[model samples]
Target: MPKRFQSVEARKLIQVSLKTNDLREARLLTGKMRADLHSEWEGRLNGSASPAAYPPDHLDMTLEATEAAYSRIRPKLENLAKQQELDNQQAYDAYLRKLRNTRDDFLRAKACKPLSVWSDLADRRISKNNWILPQGSEGYDTFVDMIAEAAIEAFNIEIARREGQFAAEPSSLVVKAGLKAKDDTAKDGETILDLFDRYAAQRLAEGRKREDGITQDRKVIDSFAKFVGPRKSIKGLTPADIRDWRDTLAALPPTYQKAKAYEGLSMRQAAAKAKAIGAKTISPVTVNKHLSTLSPFLGWCVTNAYADRNPCDGLFFGIVKGKNPRPPFSKGQLEKIFASSLFTGFLREGQEHKPGIQRADDWRYWIPIVCLFTGARVGEIAQLRIEDIQLDDGIPFLLIRHDESTGQRTKSGASRVCPIHSELKRIGFLSFVERQRSRANGKATCQLFPELEPNERGHIGAKPSRFWRDYLKRIGVKSGNDGLGAHSFRHTMADALRTAGYLDDEIEVALGHNQKTVTAGYGRVRQGTVKRINTMLEAITHSYISFSK
Candidate 1:
């Protein structure tokens, strides 16, 4: 076994018998066995051993599946050859040169690090299928091998065709014509779902979308695909189809996707069930969210010539906004929240509601206060590193930015510097920062709230948000999803700033909202800008509740 294979668990190892007495046959069998072991070990090392982590398509390692995967990309190879033949002599020579360069690059990459090359091809397949594959799984490795084989076969065929010799059997003219006809048909014969996958991949690759956002958009699009029949082509999409989907979405119950009652049922079927049960359906706002995702997707399809026009155009004009918008925390609610056991006193770490002498200075204690003053989102505050707190020309400010290495992301992909409010400084926020720094002991990358771990979606704030919601209920300030929770603190800050006579742009800058005007991107937030924001923050007053209490 290789040194790499040593890391694999002993339980995963298998013993095989050649089951032959002949020496020559035994040698051949042993060699084949060795190769198989190596492939399996490589697959395990690459992280493909877990079947649960991959999509269903990835699990299929059959020869037929491999051939089908190859067939999907064969048209592009054939089209390249056809184009070279039609071009002028100079253009033809250029085409050959390009192919030679491409082949050389491919060969070099394969020879140096073959798995990476194979993995790249496998990624393309996964992207086309709209499935995410864990980089190193047995299934992914299998697909990589299959794709590599297909790609090699394709290169060989191209090489032979270039040499004016048909080394392998060629497709019949009838078959070729049928394939060409298929390609000529609607968007290279790709389904609406297929085009959506491509659009999603492009968006993700361009950093235009986040993984969480992509996951959400995928859910909406997948539901839409199911509603319209997954096999439906992009060209066949009509305004009527979109309207029908919107109507169906409005009729379905909230969280119908995860509800046990609606499990294994189609969208129409679930909606029908919801209607029969007289259950409360999703709001117009929720319906619009689905449309919002689809509208841009369809727009992309149209831009790419997959469709004639976006069917979702002007569809949102009909959706009336929901009446129950999230409102800011009331003055009385703020009083009760600050006076809660978590702040004044708590029995212990976990039991935050019970009255006791213990006053915890953790996320539960500080996150809300930081949000109340800075107007930063709960997630933003929750993900703050010790280094994020800094002083700019005697003005202490928070550097709110997306750090990909730390998995901290801003909502708008834009970073902002927000001056620490005077109230927070007066109440010992800076002292808290120093204490955290002391605890970190010069570790610049240490998180301010290290106790808060990221959830499955890589959101550090999710658990804290849940804790806030539960705390709100315990303190009788909120009940259920009554549109009042941690976010209300941000809303409260915005309202307070507005009441303090701050301009909209100034408040937006303080709150880290993505600037819409071109001039907003002129320069970095300087010391003067930080001072102005600090002055604006100081203007905010809550006379009803005293922090000194």
Candidate 2:
């Protein structure tokens, strides 16, 4: 009987032949040998034991000499381990990308039927990667578990080869990297969800004066969390995971669904239901928005040391410039909009539906019109107060500023004055304001459009946008699946300005865009500048062919 023990740290073997032949005696000898070997190993581990002795002729080739050699090579070994970790990450990302590309090609080649119908095809494709168990099949969970184990085993083997020491457990490595294990919380760092909440709260705190992006960031982070998995470790979130999430986003349905059938379902469930019903997919720009929002949060994670890297750093969805999802309205479309029942006669006072322009100063009536001339965002126009309308030396303009008093939201330096164009004055806008002010009887009403109110989400434009969409449908306008909704009017204004030979700066100023220049940081745009802007805006003229007429 032979008793054998290998020392990983020493890169040496201990072998002894037991003189006894009986099974009981052999077992006793094995236990004794293991205890002696472990005692030696413990001494070596604590740097207290002498190296293995060698023959006089081989004095330089002993275990002590080898340990000295290893000491000289330790830094190289550490570098190799780091490089191996990087290589593993790269390999995993490449494999995931290949899988995704294969799946996409397969779906394109065959008709996209139900999951069950393509089960065999998926199995066949997955087998090419040598996944022992099939995807979407029995013991698939086991397959996933085995793959993770295999990866860890490979990593451990590499560590042992390089360092001449057996690697620690995979869970320990993950914990050391500041990521949680599946069954255990990480001792080093916080969970992704916790970090996300803190990140969101921090943003909210920073933007206490204006919180336009706070809700949007929360929504996008929620989507990212859901896509990756609720309990996934932030430190474990790889580039492969981000790629998978992006692929999932490509297949997802539009956020704004026409049907209300899947209202109460989760985003995942709703997406599945939407696909089942053949609902439209979201645009590349929207997918990019999802990426953009998530990237900053991951960057924040990196800053806080919760994550080593931002997985979404350079990844982007390619957008075709001419294939704009949200195209501006044509002149004909604008005419139809102004000639709609809401503007003509169907709108009535106090009643939701009546025979004449009911709420004359309503946001629903004015926002689209305001968007056409000023190219302002719907939220900005929707949340306007009476005080925002300012008159400077007989010239009237709208001061689109972020006012905490009125709960108006705007991005940093999204404050600019847009001169009220000639078309708005022609449409009785100033007259309507005067009437409302007269009715207020010296007490100023806070809101410009008193009929409009904020929704539960605290977005002033939400309800009005819904109502506008329904109105678009009622007026026989095909609001394209691409973001060409009521907001297209803003695009239309930009196009109109560009068509009229307006400079890019002029257009940016009109839209209250945060100018990225030293001069822009100087002071408020002068009243003279507003007058010039109104001249550029005056070029936006559409001859209405009224349905009422």
- Which numbered prediction scores highest in lDDT against the true structure? 1
Model 2 per-residue lDDT tens digits across residues 378-453: 8787877777788976778888877666677766534677788877787777776776666666455467777778
The TM-score leader among the candidates is 1
TM-score of each: 0.64, 0.59
lDDT tens per residue, model 1, 1-549: 567788875645566776656554455446646786788877788887543343645223333234443455566777877866545777767776776676676666545655465676667656655555566777666566555555555565566676577656324332333334344334443776667656766776668887677777888888788777666677777899999998888899988888999999988999999999999988887788889999999999889987889989877746445654668998889998887788888898778988888888788888989888888899999988999998899999998878776788899786677889878888898888889989999786899998989887788999989999888898889987688878888888899989988877777877877788877668875323777778888888776776742
By summed lDDT, which 10 consecutive residues of candidate 2 come out lowest?
56-65
Evaluated at residue 139, the lDDT of candidate 1 is: 66
